[model samples]
Target chain A: MYRQPVSRLWWLKKRTYFVFVMRELSCIFVAWFAVFLMVMVFAIGRGEASYQRFMDWAASPVVVAINIVALAFLVLHTMTWFVLTAHATPIRVGGRRVLAMREARVAGRIVPAATAVRVGGRQVPAAMVIASQYAGLVVVSAFIAWLVLR
Target chain B: MTKRHIEPIVWLLFSAGGVAAAVFLPILILLFGLAIPLGWVRPDYNYLDAVVSHWLTRLVLLGLLVVMLFHSAHRFRYTLHDGLQLRWEVPIAVLSYGGALLGSAAALLIVLTI
Candidate 1:
């Protein structure tokens, strides 16, 4: 069977493809965060001196710069993931699916009465799903902050 | 007996991990990586130590670590396959999942000991 030759740099050919690759690459940063948490926990388990040493290493310029970059990629990952979720998961409420339907309106005497009859057919919107994800993020972050900062 | 497919199991972990990481990692990273280290948010060692040593806290941390690692592994496996065009599927799967397992074991040890 014949096939089109794919370039090694195929991801760079288009903006969306580049972004997709970057999103995939963001997993590295996610893994880094997991490792970082593990190390932090290990240090905390050791002693005050070990924890302080870990903090000192973390405060170094190199580590800080790496984390800043990682943070940017992670935010991108979060936003894209949430947006994708809205499309992938069809949320249901009271046996109704959230849909992108427009409200029917009567124009004039020529307009059909059937258009106006569907007024009470209310449905949830996809935007609500996206908004709720952001709200959940805020709540989780706030809880973590309260736990740590308080 | 019929054989069970592993794709759905790993995919479920990947999806859950993505949600867990999305909602949780940013704040933790912002605090521990940037804010506290840069002196923006002062951390009390005693308070933090006590919190880390808490059984509930350790349990939560273990869960996060395991899921996040598996999530990373699943994503990275695809990144290698599709992004880098690495055709070694079995080795990649073994390496990725194996690494996540190792990380989870390490997390279990650290959290349990702590």
Candidate 2:
């Protein structure tokens, strides 16, 4: 399908690319996040001591490298993901979406800023607003941590 | 679906998933904290292996991967077209769908293998 010319480019700038980079590189976390289970499978397949050794080695510096990579990306992804909540965020259980129209409008603007900032753009209002949303995400995540951890 | 219905559905799934991951993160940390003192959750043991062992966990993993994949797809796709001025629409579409597919596969495989 020959589509019409698009107006903006998302992956071209620093801030915009931050989210893009976060998204593309996020695979590392999903891969490594599941590593424990993967190692478990490996350990179970091999035997007990080998599993223990694997766990130890997995916790080693090199493994930590993998984990740090995984963890950092996970945080990046989480932040990026949470950042989406302001606009793209919805509250739907039983498939009934409860997000109002204004929330949807905000989400529409914010979600693309992740891309907009990348293409040599200046949307300060959008950025500030989104940053505030991130503030909310931090608060919410903290609250969530409190709730979940407690 | 009309625009009203369509957008809400997307945003709803998107928000829900983000919150889900947000919720899961701390829980996972706590799980780790407990597993440490308890000793039964030994690092030597394959906990990841155990998650995949349960069919429910497997499905949950798959759901998380797929939902987030679609959410990201919806995200990255629009950003590329509207924000990135990328002319190549096919690749973006392919990747968006492909990510979901591959994510589903990886999630399922990890589970089934265990």
Candidate 3:
């Protein structure tokens, strides 16, 4: 026999449930990012002028707003993902369980910082690279806030 | 094969995609969207273009596209089934996974052709 359906609002009953929903929703932005990368690749293939125009369009206010919102959602997704991973996968060493928080810390800090390392290359310090990411985040947030307030 | 057998494989792809997205997405957004445009990091168009056109980069991107799409498919499939309380699991799974496969093919077409 068929069972009665669960409420659509079932995820709202707990904070973790809500976070899980948000984490799942983050896939939309991840897909958007993939599309964005494809567009950039396409523009690059079309040559210099097209790439310039693509950059110009990316700089537009509408794109800026979308990016800011996407960043917020992405951050939420990343943080929740780390927390979930920590619990879901545990490592054991010599019959002792290793700390999942260690995994969380490395993932939260090191992986994101590696992007800065790549961007900075050999010329920039690791600290500087990490700092720049934070700085960029702050600057974008400030710009968004200004846009909202103005 | 049964539907039960496909679950773990789809999950493996989804997990791989999740790890990739978590690592790359934040940085890519910062660099392209905020930093370069805001003049925090000057974008070298020629250099960037050269990097994108490289064979290895294209391969990595293809992997990214496939895994990311599968990740999205699995997540969205569950979202529809559980969140929306949709009982039609078979069709939802087929549509979600099938759409993701189509997307992967589209990405491959673009990357290879252009």
Ranking by DockQ: 1, 3, 2
Per-candidate DockQ values are: 0.43, 0.20, 0.30
Model 3: residues with Cα > 4 Å off, grouped in runs: A1-4, A94-150
Model 3: per-residue lDDT, tens digit, B1-114? Answer: 226667657767887787667666776777777766666666577777667778877898899888988988877877786677786878888888898899888889778965
Q: Deviation in angstroms for A95 in model 1? A: 4.4
**Of 1 and 2, which scores higher on lDDT?**
1
Model 3 CA RMSD to the hidden true structure, in angstroms = 10.5
Model 1: pairs clashing at backbone N, Cα or C within 3 Å:
none
Q: What shift in Å separates residue B85 of candidate 2 from its native position after superposition? A: 3.9
Can you write out model 1's per-residue Cα lDDT over B1-114, one digit (the tens) per residue?
Answer: 112367656766887788888999999999998998888988788899999999999999999899989989988987887777777978988899999999999999999998
How far in Å is the alpha carbon of A133 misplaced in model 2? Answer: 13
Give the TM-score of each candidate: 0.87, 0.50, 0.73
Tell me the lDDT of model 2 at A4: 60
- In order, candidate lDDTs are 0.82, 0.50, 0.69
Error of 2 at B87 (Å): 2.1
- Model 3 whole-model lDDT (C-alpha atoms): 0.69
TM accuracy, model 1? 0.87
* Number of the top-ranking candidate, with DockQ as the measure: 1
Looking at candidate 3, what is the lDDT of residue B47?
Answer: 72
